[model samples]
Target: MAVTGGLIYRGIWKSSKRFGPFPKLAVAGILGFAVGKASYVGTCRNKFQQLGLEGGPGSGPWSRRGPSGRGHRSCHHVFEDCKKKDQVAPAGEA
Candidate 1:
């Protein structure tokens, strides 16, 4: 991103000499690296599944340490129980 911004700045803002193909090559290299890593990880996942292994040790590819977007199931149960009690509460305790 920096290289791209520099190239654009030099070409338009400064109107100075271009940085040749270096900036383009740098961007391409960065993108290529990202694609390569994704492909490698995907290959590892496929092989692991083929071997019938559940998950490996030490931050395995199959392990998801991030949020699943569904929130926690235990928290949902607690909230449901609270709602149930609240519905049954006496009118004097409102």
Candidate 2:
């Protein structure tokens, strides 16, 4: 990122000379990296269900870490307990 920024900085520094500085562009490049990593983690989660973990936008995916660092469960191991508890929670909670 820094290298890219340096190249971009040199390429645009002269044009931006009138402004205070081109730091904002460099900051944007850095923030882009963080956004890239977060999206990557989400993409890697596609195997969550296959790993015996839940696969949804809500609670199911948050509660199933196995003893080993990696999760391992049959594909059918849905969150039966979570579903039961979910039924009794406030209507807005589901």
lDDT of 1 by residue, 1-94 (tens): 5655566657753332577556565666799789889889867877766775434243343235312122323232446765677679776442
List candidate 1 stretches off by more than 4 Å. Answer: 1-18, 50-53, 57-94
Error of 1 at 89 (Å): 44
Model 1, residue 42: C-alpha shift (Å) = 2.0
**Candidates' lDDT values, in order?**
0.55, 0.55
Number of clashing pairs per prediction, in order: 0, 0
lDDT of 2 by residue, 16-76 (tens): 5565345656666778888998888776677664565444333343446432222533344
| Candidate 1: clashing residue pairs, number | 0
TM-score of 2: 0.35
Highest TM-score among the candidates is held by which one?
A: 1
For model 2, where is the 10-residue window of minimal lDDT? Answer: 65-74
